[model samples]
Target chain A: MLKEILYYTWGAVVSFVLAFSVGITYMGLNRKVTARVQNRIGPPWYQNFLDVIKLGSKKTAIHHGVMHHLGPAFLMVSSVMSLLIIPILNNGRFYPNLNFHGDLIFLLYIMTFGPLGMALGAGQTGNPNSAIGVTRGLAQMAGFEIPWVMALVALMIQYKTTSIVDLMNIQAETGRWLMFSSPFAFIAAIMAMFGMFRYSPFDIVGAPSELASGPMSENGGKYLFTMMSSGSVFAFAKLTLYTDLFLGGADNLLVLVLKTFVLYMIPVLYGVVNPRYRTEQAVRWFWGWPSFFGLLAILQASFF
Target chain B: MINDKESQKIVDIIQNFARKHSLWVLAYGTGCGAIEIPPTMTSRYDAERLGVRGAATPRQADVLLITGYLTTKTLKRVIRVYEQMQDPKYVIGFGSCTINGGMYFDSYNTIKALDRYLPVDVYINGCMPRPEAVLKGFAKLQELIQAGKADGSKKYKENLEWYRANQKEVIPVWRMPEFNW
Candidate 1:
């Protein structure tokens, strides 16, 4: 028992480190790509690393209360937990025993843990802008979750299994990735992923111009650092989950990285040139065609 | 194990390097000099290449860019913002207006010298410094950071009384909270 616990602990640590490094690097690439898109040379790829370190090194920190301090801790925990649950390599070669039998629903709930914790912390700050930002974020979450959950339900029903590992095995055996097999579900999930990525058109929560970063208006120094790091980890977790679900679970680290990076670019590239939507508009857009695609996906799953 | 002091020294060096590379500016454009910021940040000049990006709020910013002549009314808001910012923060007094109030030097409304109110780490000269000059000023600030000479926050803390007095004299009401270090 003790040996198993030690192995699990080691696995968790490795997963955390992997998620952080890969996620931060992806962010740096995103910035570089965005700069190139705008016809300007961007900062070095290590710019994000320097930013996080600089934020961590700030001379002062402010906390409204215990919850404010704990918010980032919760965000970190949720992302870390999600990373651990999502298998990174095929047949779970990387961390074999760590992938539990049934974590699909748990993964969905865990994904929201960061935002919910952040909302509570923002509430305690008593800043109206933070409150506004949190409201928009929660609303957007609700909007996206419908189509997202529908996509997941369609997959679960079609596969007749709750275990992600089982889902991967099914995909490998059938020799048809879910992306090709269930095109409607893929479209719906991809649409929801845009909001999950918090890119342009759907980025009402932390509208920098309108709300001064919204929920994070009061967070600075190490507080901001923690948020940024957790965000990267969460980004990796979400991307990995999508790759496992839609694309066949990657056979190697290189394939996994490429799949995840391509998946990440969908929302990011969309965000680069588009103007942002108001909170209501964002919610409406998610519910409109995306919801329709999700419904069609579910119907197709049930009928065929 | 390394001693605490040794660890702290190593940490300080790392922190300084990171801080120099990622300078998030709260460009609180209080005057016409605000117009120049777009040119500086856009594709033409690309301030972002130097890792100098605009921050939306004082909380997230490392450098406060006071872009031009500050009237008495605006000075109050500026002081409030400066206090809200977390430290080890730097202030850049941009444009000749910020140094000696430019054309507004004799005006009763505008405050002539910004450093009297806020500890400025760098000053860029010109009626309105072009994007090139603005970039040069940022380079100067980066040099100051590397040399360990830009300790404006520390200076502000040490001479809080004098700074506060100057602040209060200009604004008679003195309604702001004392931002204790």
Candidate 2:
């Protein structure tokens, strides 16, 4: 039992490290890419690393209350938990610990954990902007989750299994990834991901101009550092989950990185070129076409 | 076989390097000089190349750029912001107004010398420093930070009493919270 616990703890650590490094690196690249797109020189690839370290190395930190302190911790837990549950490689031998059957439903619940924790923390700060940002974030989350859940339902129904490992196995056996098989679900989920990534058009929650970074307005020093790192880890978890669910599960680390990076670019590129929508407009956008595509995916799964 | 002093020095060097590279400026536009910030941030100057980005709040920001002349009213808010920021923070007295109130030097309500109330790490002496001069000021701050010369936060902590007296004198209706470093 002790051995099993130790192994599980070790596995969790490895997964956390992997998600954090990849996610932060992608964020740095996103900045560089955005800068280049605007015809300007950008910070180096290690810029995010420096920012994280500097924030962490701050000599002082402030908290509104216990919840404020617990907020980032909760966010960290959710991301780490999600990362642990998601399978990175198709081969079972290397990462066999957490890829259990009947985990799709659990994954869905855990995915919402970070935002809720963040909301609680933001609420504790007594900042009106943070409150407004939280409300918008939760609303946007509700908007996107409908289509996202529908897509997940369609996938589970089509595959006749809730285990991510089984879904990945089915792809390997049929030699056709779900992205091609259920193109409608892929489209729906990808659209939902635009909001999930919190880029342009859907970044109303943290509208830096209007909301002053929303939920994180009061967080500074080590608190902000924790939020930043947790955000990166959560980003990786979501990307890996999508890569596993829609794209075929990767067989090797390099393939996984490439697939995740390509998937990561979709929302980022869209964000760069678009203007933000108001809260209601974003909700309307998500519920409109994305929901329709999700329904179509469900229909496709049910029929021929 | 490194001694304790040597290891501490190495860590300090690393921290300084990281701090120098990443300077998150709080987006608090106090005066007309705020106009120059957009050009500095956007493609024309591209402050991101120097690892300088605009932070939305005092807590997350490392540098407080007092853009121009500070009215007595605005000085209260600026002091509040400077206090809320975490340790190792720096303030740049941007534009002539921030240095000596520039065009507003004789204005009764405006504070003439920013350094009297808060520690000024770098002073850019233009009526309104252009984006180029602003970037140069940032570069200077970064150099000060890397060389372990930027101790503005420390100075503020040490002279909190005197600074508060100055602040209280300016804003007689002083309702600002007691700064605890």
Candidate 3:
């Protein structure tokens, strides 16, 4: 029992530290990405931190019920938990003993929990704008989920195990990276995940001009900071996952950083080129034909 | 009792999402006062430094910083933009057009009160308000941010009469647009 407790405790601690570091890096990188896209210079990495602190000192107001208040709290909880699950660095060497068996699938599902909680809380608060935003968000999730699941499942089949550690190990051995062997599989996966990350084109949820930050309309102070941090860390984890999975990680820290940054640019570039997807269009296209290919990849690996 | 680092980090994250990274400006630049938006945003006022930037589309922003005047014609677009904006959104009336109609009180071209069409969070005064007045409005918004005084979400839900007033015109239980739906 003590050993198990120590393992989980270590997991949480490691995740927190790693998430913090990568969060800073991505904050800087995203600024540059957005700045380039918007024809302006974005703020420094530490700028995000300063803004959060300033808002944390803002006035506090409670909405509808204790539930509305709890919304941000729950959102933060889910985001941190999701961050804790990604197999960053050599941490995957700990494998099934330390981590859950079906962690990849679990992590993906848990990832949605934070956003879902926020949406639900938005519903409870009863802001029609957010209500509309959350509705759109849920629809988009429904759209992209099939393609995402299909892409990951295809990869999972190739590794012949749902354990993320095993998948990483499989990649480590092949000398044949999945992205190189099956570039289509890789692109499809990234696109779906990228959409889920809610940058630019998929930014229908808190479209500030439209929904006034959507479900985030009511949050301020510490709660506001919490969401911002969650967003940054979540994006970091997402990019790291792509790097670790698709681009292949190196033993050297600099190599790993470089790979992550390149991978990060894919979505950022996509954002610059693409316009925000109307909620209905995002959903319709998400569940459309591209998802079919992802499903095909999975079936090919599983049966053929 | 709040020793949970996880929750604390989460709270910090939520706050940052609202304040720091993407301060979404509402799309509709209605009223002649809407002209001030350019200087305040692009260079002179530099709202960008405060993480305030205009979102070309409504679905991407959080703060709908309305500049002024709601002409009857523009009122349609203003309501449409308000509707276009996604959740967790905020509405600010930039000038006289926002509060009880700045100078268009007697003119049929302008809506008497901007709030009559949409919920207004902060109202900055002046015929064509200076950027300083706009800054004060932003500061007041910052206070709301500081105090965490966000009843906009809850109040909007429980009693939507205010938002309804913005979305539709009420004509004393008569002469209202009849929807066949």
Candidate 4:
């Protein structure tokens, strides 16, 4: 029993480390890609590592209250929790920590836990910008989550199961990725992803020009460092979740990285050329077409 | 076996190296010198290649870029912003206005010297420094950071009384929070 517990603990740590590094690298690559698109040579891919380290080494951090201190901690908790539950590889020796049946529904709820925790922290700061940003973030989350949940519900009804592992296993057995099998659900989820990633056209929550980075205006030093790492971890877990659900979960680490990177580019590339949307427009956007596709996915799942 | 002092030095080296590479400049567009920043940040002169990026707020910023001249009115806010910044912060006084008030030299309102009000690590000396000059100023700041010479925050803490005296002379009505570093 002790050895099993130790092994699970070790696996969780390794998975966290892997997810963080991959997520940070993807963010760095996003910067590089943005730079190249704009006819400029960007910073190196390892720039974020230097940034996180510098933030960690900073001498002072100010907090308004206990919630402010716990905001990033809350974000980290949600991120690690999601990483542990999301299976990293299909048949790997090291990954898929703490995953269980009916985890898909649990995953969806847990993913939003961090942001709400952060909102509580942001509210405690008494910064009006942080308040506005948190509202915008939550509103946008409400907007995107409809289609995102619809997509998941469609999959659940179609498969008659809530386990992500079961979904991957079904895909493996049929030798068909769900992206082709459930095209509307994929389309809806992809649209929702634009908001999920918080890119342009939906990036009002942290709109630097208008809101001074919105929810994160007061966070600095160690708080910012923790937030950054958690953001990366969360990003990786979300991407991995998408890959497992639609792209047929990876058989190995290299495949996992490749598939996740390809999945990651959808939002990053879309964010590059597009301009931002106001809060209402962003919320309305998700309600319009993505939600339409989501309905179609549900209809298709039930009848056909 | 390394001695404690040597081990400390090694850690400092690594810390300084990271600090030198990642500079999140607070976009405090104080004066006409702010015009030059857009060009410096955008495609023609991308500062990100040097790991210089704009930070949204003073709390998250490492470098405070004071663009253009400081009027007695704006100085209070500038001082507040500077204090809000965490430790190991830097100040880059941009343009000739920051150096000696430039065109505002004879103006009654503008402070002629920026150093009196705030500790400046680097000064880009031109009436309006071009993007090239701005990047050069950043490079110089990076060099200073690596050498452990850019200690403006330290200087501010050490001579808080004197700095407060200077700040009080211009502002007159000082109703600010007690700056506890």
Candidate achieving the largest TM-score: 4
Better of 2 and 3 by lDDT: 2
Tell me the number of clashing residue pairs for each predicted model.
Answer: 0, 0, 63, 0
RMSD of each: 1.3, 1.5, 8.3, 1.3
**In DockQ, how does model 2 score against the reference complex?**
0.86
Candidate 2, residue B51: the lDDT equals: 97
- Assess the local accuracy of residue A52 in candidate 4 as a C-alpha lDDT between 0 and 100: 92
Interface RMSD of each: 0.8, 0.9, 8.4, 0.7
Every model's DockQ, to 2 decimals? 0.86, 0.86, 0.08, 0.88
lDDT of 1 by residue, A1-304 (tens): 9998998888888878888889999999889988999999998898999999999989899788998888888888888888888988888688654567669988888899889999999999999999999999999999999999999989988888778888888889999999999999999999999999898888899999999999999999999999999999999989999999989989988999999999999998999999999888999999999999999999989999
Residue-level lDDT tens digits of model 4 in B17-112: 999999999967889889999889999999999999999999999999999988899999999999999989999999999998899999999999
Query: What is candidate 2's lDDT per residue for A1-304, written digit by digit as tens?
Result: 9998898888778778888899999999999988998889999999999999999899999888999888888888888888888888886644555767799999999989988998998999999999999999999999999999999999988889999988888888999999999999999999999989899979899998899999999999898888889999989988988888878888888988999999999998988888889999999999999999999999999895
- Highest-DockQ candidate: 4
Spell out the clash pairs found in candidate 4. none
Candidates' chain A TM-scores = 0.98, 0.97, 0.89, 0.99
Q: How many backbone clashes does candidate 3 have?
A: 63
Name the regions of candidate 1 deviating beyond 4 angstroms: B4-7
- Model 3 chain A: which ten-residue window has the lowest total lDDT? A90-99
**In model 3, where do residues sit more than 4 Å from their true spots?**
A1-11, A91-98, A250-252, B1-31, B43-46, B53-181
Residue A161 in candidate 1, Cα distance off native in Å: 0.6
Clashing pairs in 2: none
